[model samples]
Target chain A: MLSIVKRILGQMKNDKRSLGLLLFAPLLVLTLLFFILSDSSYVPKLAVYDMSEKFVAELENHATVSEETEKPEAADYLEDNEIDALIWSDSAGTHIELLEKNSKSAVALEAIQDTNKALQPTQKELIIDYVYESTGDNQLDSLSFVFLGVISFFFVFILSGMSFVRERFGQTLERMLMTPIRRIDVIGGYTLGYGLLAAVQSVVIILYAVYVLQLQVEGSVALCTLVMILMAFSAVSVGALVSIFANNELQLVQFIPVIIIPQIFFSGLIPIDTIPFGLGNLCYLTPIYYGCTALEMIMIQGKGVVEIWPWLAGSVVFIGVLFLANVTALKKYRRL
Target chain B: MKIEVCEVNKSFKQQQVLNQISLTIAGGRIFCLLGASGSGKTTLLRIMMGAIPADGGSVTVGGIAVPNRQLLAEMGYMPQNEALYEELSAWENLKFFAGLQRQSRKTFAADAEALLEIVDMAACKNKLIRDCSGGMKKRISLAVALIHKPKLLVLDEPTVGVDPVLRRKIWLYLRQLRNEGTTIVVTTHVMDEVTQCDDAALLRNGHIIARDTVKNLIAQTPDGNIEELFFIDNQSEAEAPLC
Candidate 1:
């Protein structure tokens, strides 16, 4: 038993990557999450074309509001702007026009109405209209919008990571090292093989989320599926790279809490912008964060690819780096 | 293709695995590397296969350095452990490996089927390796290694877990491969396995103690068996222990 323990520790001591993973993966995840989910108030942004001085003061107390001049051009300011809603005030009551309808916008509109209701003892009704024209018919699944992207990233990451670890433990990778197969080609082949399954999976998930669950996807079905596929591909690359550092399946599973779970918080499932200011930047570190953010932009917010190009570009870069890291990790087995 | 391992030295931190080992692997014959578990057989084979770097010295095959990927396609290497995916069927394993070896399925499908039949694994070609017994996995691994019809076959303890009958069949297949002008290098701890090889090298404690034909080796030992040589060496080493 002593010798057995010694041998296991001896093997682990030499494997610097596994040691680093054991010591730091969890710490990293916890640190990021602690900062992200820390106590902080989120202030919503609201703009008014023309409003009563009393109403503006009441709204400013609860949100970040701008008192713009009552120009006709300010109506167009509500289009694709950061202002959650346009609060129009007249003699009758307070009416709000929403540019987009999502959890964030919905919450913002509700807060505005609640604040306006308290302010006006005379006016009783709050009128809410949408620029994109929401029928207010369906009960939208808000979390699944981000969950759809996050889960796809999560599953693909695990599958690809486990498969690579299995290949190593079974000696299949060692056999490949013996053959004439170029290391990059091995990575490419795995990415494509898993990428194919991931692509199909993403489409099925999108269809299920959109048509079956009626999850309120507002983007092009085809483009949303393609973005999901790209996210899956990025996940595959990440999985391959991460699995290289793990020695076995159990060790690979250890990566889930560190790599997969934290991305849920960062992936906009809980509204990343609401997580306060400093921690919001850390979302860029996770690939799933880009995918989830992009999905939210395209699906719930009805933005096109051009709007989410930075997130898309960031995910592409993540995949590229992971692909290189995977190829380099194979160098431990065979120099070629 | 000829492999020349020149004064190869390897160490794992403090424990030396190979000690200035050198050997000339002649082409077109069956060569057996007989040694016990820790006698550096796998390490030496890995060096010859160009899968790992040597601490000192070098190995060259067909006049190129150990790890020339272009020349590696001509060599089929099967490590001590059976290197097949348990989740995949025998056919899938063969197809994936052959594809990685850059052989088109359309071109090598018949050859792969013939190789499977040779290993007597045709019946379970579609069954997952996880369901197969230990011996079946070894046989499937053998079939995969030969899928590309490599010119130089390097095997490390390829017959470790195989049954006697199947082992006999595999030896015959190796003999056939050697006769077809494929240079074969096989490592085994079993003394009897060396008798069938054209040439043999005995290693103990990371040193090649002897290298000769079966006839010459048997003639040199009193009991006319290589195991006698192994026992004599072990007995002497015990009487006068190394510092």
Candidate 2:
């Protein structure tokens, strides 16, 4: 056991790049998440022209509403980027016209809704015109969580698996085996090393998505971290276990589509109901299904630990079973 | 009192790699298992090292049966391939293997350095194995195998790709180990190396066709050299058994 620690430390000392990836990759990724989530603020500018003094006051309260003198000039004001929406009051009640520019229609629609509420009981109809989404409403934040889960699983799986497989093909595994070290020691060392690496990666990616990317993390960050760590554990174990079947590094990479893609399909990235019954149950069998589902529940739906524990539990079980399989597979060289 | 094998037979599916073969090697003796490729010489060595079990036979090392862990602990094995980690420096590789043997840090540090010196690779101990020459890698592998200073040493064609000068040096080291009560088992197809063995076993098609001292085998075959004796034995095997 002491030897395993020494060996792991020796290996880490020798491979600076892997060590760096293991220690700082999560921090780098988390920093990226911070920047992406926190940088954007929605403070849409608005201009009101020919509005009743009461309506103008309401608009000014909700947004940066400027009073314009002319209707024709209101269009000019919107084009000049002075406001995101325009309101013109006439005999047909207070007609709210939204400006179209390098602005989001959802933001414009939201502004219109707020204006209508502020002018309630006045019977003013809110007019919303979007340059885009004229056919149907589109969600900008849709599927961002799913995409995040996919990217996180991919990087964790490939990097972890490739590193483990290289140790085998490079004959480092055989050299280590020649020692009096137990089989469990090798498995434990790799699991702890890569497990720690994947945990940090998950934290970085999740934190970046929430705080940096500004993706709506409606649930607790602690729960998200828990799910990420579980998912990483599953991924690292699966990666290392699958590595045993691979004869070379290229063979290890070839497993990505087979091993990783199925998880994306089953992990709630796609609607499970849309899949055929036989195939839908296959998703239940994949670790990613549980991981992504838990992530989505926490990050998108704001669900807590009690709601997502089953999925988390399933992922933990998968990791444990795969770890055992990895240890068993190594018995081909030395039994017991 | 070193190694004993009785009627060992091994087969891979329909093909037999080791026929009924038996031999005993005394402690502190250099025994060379001589054979061409596919002669099952390596199989015999592997069985003795407890790397593989014989299909039908018993191998006893010291007094215990083959495949015993305790016996294996006392044996140093150098595979045909230089199985050192390519990414690690020679010193690091030695340190890892020595640690596996449960050797203390201070004890193995000096032993590893001494073995490196013996292999004439002390200067390049810190260099990664991938950056080393083929001969240097082989020498380093030998150093690692001997790091634990096992009582019995098994080398599988340790001098295959080595130059003559280095090969001679390796043989000298084997002899030195043998003189120090370390029973050495080596496999070779090089006929000249056969003469240096205290006893030689000529294996062909998994059968021990000849087992005796090199001088006795040469005397019986009317050839002063092992190369001639090898050819004579192969020619006789090609012909039918005389009535």
* Highest-TM-score candidate: 1
Instruction: Give the per-residue lDDT of model 1 (tens digit) for A1-54.
Output: 222223224333444564455334433443343345343466778887678888
Worst 10 residues of 1 chain B by lDDT: B234-243
Q: Which candidate has the highest DockQ of all?
A: 1
Worst 10 residues of 1 chain A by lDDT: A1-10
Q: After superposition, how far is residue B243 of candidate 2 from its true place, in Å?
A: 28
Off by over 4 Å in 1: A1-140, A270-277, B104-107, B233-243
Q: After superposition, how far is residue A308 of candidate 2 from its true place, in Å?
A: 2.9
Docking quality tier of model 2: acceptable
lDDT of each: 0.77, 0.74
- Candidate DockQ scores, in order: 0.28, 0.26
Error of 1 at B49 (Å): 0.7
User: Best candidate, lDDT-wise?
Assistant: 1
Clashes of each: 0, 11
List residue ranges in candidate 2 displaced over 4 A: A1-9, A16-149, A159-175, A207-214, B218-223, B233-243
